[model samples]
Target: MLEDAGGHVRDADDDQMRLECGVFGAWNVAESSAITALGLHALQHRGQEACGIASFDGQLFHTERHMGHVGEAFSGTDLVHRLPGRYAIGHTRYATSGASVIRNVQPMFADLEASGIAIAHNGNLTNFRALHTQLVAEGSIFQSTSDSEVILHLVARSRKGSMEARFIDALSRIEGGYALLALTNECLIGARDPLGIRPLVLGELDDAYVLASETCALEMIGARFVRDIEHGEVVVISGKRTLRSSRPFPAARARPCLFEYVYFSRPDSVVNGRSVYDVRKRMGACLAQETGVDADVVVPVPDSGVPAALGFAQASGIPYELGIIRSHYMGRTFIQPTQGVRELGVRMKHSPNRQVLEGKRVVLIDDSIVRGTTSRKIVRMVREAGAREIHFRSASPPIKWPDFYGIDMPDRDKLLAARKTLAEMQEILEVDSLGFLSVDGLYHAMDAGPRDPVHPQFTDHYFTGEYPTRLLDREIAEGRNDPVERQLSLLVTA
Candidate 1:
């Protein structure tokens, strides 16, 4: 199920990459209807697998969950008019654990005998199997295989007196990254796991308090950016009050996943006040500072690599050119979540430009190389366009490990980098030369800023065979944290 979902697009601009899911939660004490709709649009880049929104009109809760983009699902007056309320929360999903089906679409909601609860989740848990086993042993039936659903069931089964206590209890049992938003009769709650593996920021629009995975969503709704929901912070906002509980909830606090900046987030986003685009560009500049042989023309794979390409060009003094043009008509695979739909989604999306590739030895810059299927295809396309030689360069180190965060990738058996060397990958991709930035290069690039270095990062198991943060690290061989590691200067001796 993980392998089949969440492909971004072929190369609309010559790059192929995966985007992690997005999360948006709004507590509209200001009573904004279209605000939630606009918030979904801002988060459109996060996940196209499915989109949903649940609103509370004080007395009743209304929800709209469907498989597609927000604009496509909630259309015209009929869909918008049905949801009228002073409080609303929304979600846009990219399938991680659960299969891509309408039945699995979220803002997942349920009505227990006592109260009805709605939730939108933006991360994955590592101990899902154990938790599922325990839950099923107690005979708590599951509606979907998604680890996210486990959270809802946990909350439902342990409904003590107050919803906050029940939610805290649910969070206590889970072991992984999550940025969750739950809406109920009296209030809205936003919770980020102790490690802060995912991002959930706080925003304000008049008297409204909105929670989202990125700052771009806040800008989309004209909401003023307030601050990041700190690592392991559980904040509850209502029409009348606001409350918060810090980390160390009888459990260890670890780290946030680093991919939120590298690939998952929109380039325009400012995660924890750090510019994601700037971070990626710095990574490229650092890479160029350390590497880059005598190359002909520097060309980015597209989209994700554009900023980095510019940085590399500036740093290396190599002229950056639009060497590869992408076919924008190609639709995104994440939009069509299911396997069958994705098979067709790729075809509908990317195409290569023959104009610049007709005769050139190009240095292709990309964020990271995962399975190498798309990379192989890209090289093939460039070759067919009459390129003399294609030198593939990755700004980040080869991703030899699969992510336990929200990204869905092929299993270990299918990950090319995990099983092969650079030469092996070059032979497979049919490239003249292939180079990836060292792990240390990427860290030096990201370390210049004033942000907390320990907040979170992708699981470094691929390069080091160890994890930067202990929260999501396990014996799984490969994996995907928040909080700083003071010992980062010690290089991983891979």
Candidate 2:
């Protein structure tokens, strides 16, 4: 069973690492809201809980936020017409940092002294709680609990002369792995964090400038990929169809999240100049070389694990087969109010093919195992199909630490790898053997060389516990900061 943002038990949580939000913005384009809707459709896999679009039609800013998929909300021409404009920004959210309420849905708009600003953010802010506390103390009335709103308040309170200056001022005050798109009266703006932990790319669609979380969105809208917005860069695109770039933060080597190549990004996307699909295949090839079992057939866990399983099969000389078939007809938001119904939904989600699994030593390949509940159930289903032995493999390294950036991972104690040894996890899953891709092997797959003790290549804290940014909220929550120190730091940053 899945839990909603309100802590209420729901149906069909996949027990995988939840995706962060996706953001898209268009400047100086015809039917920009429609274009943004198309981009959101391509990025639907990133976040499904809610979607919102904000557009400026010269005189007034029109906004619409809805609960559910982008197709459900914006597929109709009538709804898209409601958001008429040549300048727009959109967001698809998964509630990584806020409750799944309508108020929390993003493209969060605020009316500033200079101009109305609509901001869509794609990552969690580490210093959010501290900033929120200080802002509230200073009389900032917040309508939403989302960390994205904090950015708007910061921009609203800035003493900067221009809208772009105010936006940069807000960015300089916040710390975390973030990719942001802002819609103002004068221009459309995009910004990446100092570490480039989240992705934001620049694209061109005729006379318009596009900013999206992934290149796949650009492809969906027939936008030409210009380049990736550099780390600590703020790009401003005015009505003249020109881009002005600036870097407001200290220079640092980029440390993009490793999970993008492993799971989060769409397979079709090219992130940081590397193909996501190719990276996953290389990861699987590396995994096969590291741990190969004598098996008759290699089977993917279906959908997410397919590319990696194919690479594993090719490298290990084992025949690849569709041992498990997933039901694509099942709606993601289908209601299952009870635990029994929810468990039944899980069973209905995936089924084993007896022809491939019966009387065979099967090697099961999955993207990663978080809590291991879903993995155990899949193993049981394969066993019921008469598999003689089940050797389970994870394409990515063990997720031993929780992510504070954006990916919605469970606490350390709840993670299967964090709590159990290999033998212990194998016993718990009732599999013949279980293996995970080593951390070094994963780095090699990305062609980034060995992991550096002083400065890592990627944001691999989930596996190595080497977080790229400060976790101010987590530290405060865990009582690791003194009250005096917390107040002093908040005063300086706030």
- Please give, for residues 340-446, the per-residue lDDT of candidate 1 as tens digits: 66444434544556676678878888888877866777777778878898888888887766555566655455567879987888899898888887777776666
Tens-place lDDT per residue, model 2, 1-494, is 45532233433445767766999999888999999999999999999899999999988899999999999989876755799889999999986323779999988998877789999999988989899999999999999888899999889888889999888888877888999999999999999999899999999998778999999999999999999999899999996688899987779999998999999999999999999999999888988999899999999997889989988998999999999999987876576777777666656779999999999999999999988989998999899999999999999998899887888777777788999999999998999999999999999989998888788989999998888877788888879988998887766642
lDDT of 1: 0.72
lDDT of each: 0.72, 0.89
Clashes (N, CA, C under 3 Å) per candidate = 15, 0
lDDT of 1 at 400: 65
Clashing pairs for model 2 are none
Give model 1's TM-score versus the native structure. Answer: 0.85
Q: After superposition, how far is residue 343 of candidate 1 from its true place, in Å?
A: 12
Q: What does candidate 1 score in Cα RMSD to the true structure?
A: 7.1
